[model samples]
Target: MVTDETPMPVLFKKSFKKLPMWDFEDVYNQDAPLRPTTCAESLRNSEDESFRKAFLPNIRLFLHKDNINLTEWNRLSHFNNPFGFMEYKYADVMASVKLIPKPKEPLLLPKPGGDGCVRCAVVGTAGILNGSRMGKEIDAHDYVFRMNGAVLKGHEEHVGNRTSVYVHTSFSITTSLYLFKKYGYTSVPNDEGIKYVMIPEAIRDFNWLEGLLKGEKGAGPYHNKWPRTYYAGQYNESRFYVLHQDFLRYVRNRFLKSAILNSTHWAIVRPTNGAFALFLALHTCDTVSAYGFMTEDYNKYYNYYFEKGVKTKVVFYINHDYMLEKNMWKKLHNSKIIRLYQRTDSGTGTEKPK
Candidate 1:
């Protein structure tokens, strides 16, 4: 029912206005079980070939401004403004940073092997992982990507311990530290050799990036001491990478393309941090399996697995079209683009199209 003609907020108003907010009691009720539609079934009935074709060509995974150069940057910047299209300002920020560290060697996106497929797992904070016991399965992949409040101490039995990549916005990194005890996120994933991918979701992120590279607090948010402990390990060039504004714009235009972009609320149409992480995996890895992302039965589970007894509903903030994201995930799964973790009566299974 979500079409380009219908605005994202209007769709939400029509479809989800009356849905009940989850209560604490819902967590104790064992009657509700996951009943996800099988990927095979969805693929068999899919009619959106045009959508698939649109995003298949250019999967701009990482932003090495050196490779993209200023010419391409200008072209893409004018094409569509991802984060409000302040190219001159963005360039200024980039130029101000003296040493922007890059990975010593490029990411092993195409692993040296027969098929050269890099298997990756993109983990979200959804509560469906509570008793899934998928920890071992998720960690078995070549790379594991986690974002936001990725609390792993007590829930390692379900969420795994290996974190190859930690994706975050400036807000998420600072907020995670701020709300450490409240959300039960004891620590951000600080394993040695782990890569940090920063999504430049706002101007604050650019400031934070400059501060991080300079090893000093900036005038922007997080003016307090930079939490260097979370980024443990020798200062290496390869440890940090920022998402390009052009790539983000491409994602919005090709995949999400929410009607909010054309309306007065252009800010709200931008993709969520989780969507950025998932798409990052899709482009970098040959095979991607998303766990804890919003499923069709998203309302049945809490917004986060770390919330013990409070069955909080996954809030669809004015900024994100969560329903549209859910549909995109489903479509990608059906098209064999990525594996979506789906819980059914039989147990948890990765949806791979035939």
Candidate 2:
């Protein structure tokens, strides 16, 4: 069992020993065929050639310090259209606004590059993904990004075999490395193959990184041992825009006053760091597929699995609510805006999903 008293690495191993495997066959084989929502279909259908030239020119605009003027900010704010409006477009604006030493140029592509068409899989670690066998399918995408306490080091058969990106928060890194050391994932991968996406959840944490390069110490408990430079998505703001912002900027401005934000459920759920990373990836990549988010059978599995007897519930220290997460997954599943693998009961009577 994953006990607090267990030795470091052993603890992680024990905790992950219970990592669930997925059943891909059951997910895609349901009697009911998956259907995309009108809104989602609209986004995909519009991603063609003529549409890109006419509508999303600025999607690739690079706004670093030298040219990142208020005039530019204000000008870009007014650049909103019916499809993607101000506030929604403003997330990348606000996030890209503040930079320390300043960036050389923006990271937007001149023309969408990489594999004739770019497809990505943004995998989340909801308990529903426990036994999901979507690894091969998830890996099939051109780019695969996974986030937040993802325990895939030893469970490759379930989550997938490759990862191009791993988003991490300081707190999560410390916590996971400490708690699940037994799983053999003793440190966050900082190697070249996997890029680290940093979310500035705390201002001090952000400043601490800034201070390191400045030759200052005692920034905080954590120290930077890696080279300092523009880590692709570092910014003061969050990386996610709510549906209201998504619709207002990406759909139509009239939606600015829509009631979606007022949904009691929407109010209850706060955006997650992983959500921000996924959206950021979407803006950069032409196509995206979402995996491992909650499915209809969430409660069946605990919010997360620490160990058979260990009591570590996947927490909500941030604004995100599990109930809201519940609804978002359902909405995404129903809309088919993104594909969510489903859990299945196998012949061995073992729990399975993909």
Candidate 3:
């Protein structure tokens, strides 16, 4: 299967790996104990049954040169096929990532003063944030997470301009500009030294990573131009990260697994990219606040924060389970695992443009 001669470091992590390796050494327990930092996080431990679960600290969260192997490739095929038929082999992907530095899991470094607090803001693209005036509040967090078609050119006041981690697939990063140009999406956020995290959801993602890390034009329909140009000139390996395959499947299998999976369109059904970004923060940060995500009154606001003119509905496609995500987010918010930003019309159940 491996076709290249590129030297690789020994990947200590494995599928469903339950032992703490390099990045997770400071935060793991074999018994799966609850190390809650805030009063909210203390409410739900691994032993809790009524609520959805967070990724255990022992689980390998990121994929780097030393954290992936052929065995992992086989085990991950069950969740979402990354490269079963593509010409791109694990060897090629590894060769590309070999250039990256070690321990890419925790992008945020250690907390200062040993205060043991890491606060994060997971900002979504839902229209609820059109005029929320939450930019200052979001920026107050230690780190901010954004995903998918994040339109932030003119709406900086609503959704804070900070993008500590931007999680996306190759397709979303490449196509988001043209897809969201109607609302002033000229470029993806390029905050000073912002960390870029890739979710390897499909073959195209692997293809994109292959060409991206090598500083070359990647194969595939969407990748006509050099993949590096999409990042707006912030393509250094030290600031880049790839999420592990098992982490994705773990999220789907445990938290966001929908009834839609039992149907024929199972392959297409998965949690929203925003959901993934939110959970990643939950596992890493000591405290988390979610903004612009789906809520019970989702239909009240426009589909996206950047949309102009009339309000639009949150369109549902077969590929994603929006309702399932909404319920789970509500549960997590209620469970004190994360703080969700919410605003209502005060019993009127009507839309009032801000």
Candidate 4:
């Protein structure tokens, strides 16, 4: 169970206790142009080849029946553990739901152009996007990934309108509907080619998948009122995907390895939904760029662009070590593995671009 009061381990206690300090000047700077910088040359010159090579495998991003031996379900059961540290019997769940088979080719394989690199943008909901005017830039990418309450109706100028993929958990989808009118989440992007990526964070997601596959909001958490229109009318099996458990575990262990995972508070130390989407792009795209994610001056922006009132500081949730994730993004940026959009005194600068 995720709780607001969960304690951080002693090793991370001090780091977690530092209150956010806002950079009001940077937040209000409207003339800043989004410039991208690359560290590829420097990273290549560094002696971290092995450190970088370990992350090059696409299999580290996800587990598919084609890539892993599903027959060894018993030995792999531990990977199916949910965010709350509760074990799930994926064997029975997998048998019940006829999952869409993994695509033979990577979804974001580069097409023949500009060095044949597949450029991707993982858009977050941070408040810094308010006047960033990054829409056209984001849409220019070969693929775009979004999640949660991605409000893009009126703010298309700040955040792009195209969505190649939308990632979410069952709870996120249901809650978006519950707060649709209030939060202005008018619709999930209805582009015909947009794929829905499911993060099976809990048992309810399994039930939700069954409902989605049947084309009826079957009996489950949504009480039969789950919107059928949210998904494609004629179900295309290829468009709906459930993230593999092993992939999620690999990410937690390698990239965002929070100290809390070793303590009794392990149940609360899962990655945020944003981290999952960002890393997913890393493996799928030739070049990945993250937008509206937390930065060193995170307190300068609102939690979300659509939020109204005095700028609210980003909250430190027990379920996510956001600081650690922020540092992870920085490290990857330094390694030229990802391009992270960050605020600079002069303007916005990104990790080394190709």
Give all TM-scores, in the order shown: 0.76, 0.57, 0.81, 0.77
Q: Write the per-residue lDDT of candidate 3 for residues 1-354, one digit (tens) a residue.
A: 432333223232233223222342123212223344543343234344554335565456677766455554433322333212123345645555565455444666435775667778999988888777788999888889999888887777778888888998887997898998887888778888898888877766767877887788886654677889899887778888887665666677668878866555655677778888987887777778999999887877778878867657788887788889999889888877778888854421123333
TM-score of 3: 0.81
Candidate 4 yields a Cα-based lDDT of: 0.64
> In model 4, where do residues sit more than 4 Å from their true spots?
1-53, 60-71, 83-86, 89-92, 112-114, 232-235, 345-354
Clashes of each: 3, 19, 1, 4
RMSD of 3: 7.0
- Which candidate model has the greater lDDT, 1 or 3? 3
**Cα deviation of 281, candidate 1, in Å:** 0.8
Rank the models by TM-score, top first.
3, 4, 1, 2
RMSD of 1: 12.6
RMSD of each: 12.6, 16.0, 7.0, 11.7
Report the lDDT tens digits of candidate 4 across residue range 1-354. Answer: 312333211122223322112232111101122122232432223455744654534453333345434333433432324421125444435533454466433555555545555678999988777667788999998899999888888779778999988888878876775674565786667677787777878667767766666666644565565535665452366766667665676677667778876665665568988999987887666678899898877776777866665656667778899989999888777877678887654332211112
Per-residue lDDT tens digits for candidate 1, residues 197-275, read: 8787655766676667766775466577573445655334467777766557657667777766556565446788899
Residue 113, model 3, lDDT = 70
Worst 10 residues of 1 by lDDT: 25-34
Full-model lDDT, candidate 1: 0.64
Worst 10 residues of 2 by lDDT: 25-34
lDDT of 4 at 263: 66
Instruction: Assess candidate 2 and give its TM-score to the true structure.
Output: 0.57
Error of 2 at 57 (Å): 9.1
Q: Indicate the residue-level lDDT of 205 in model 1.
A: 65
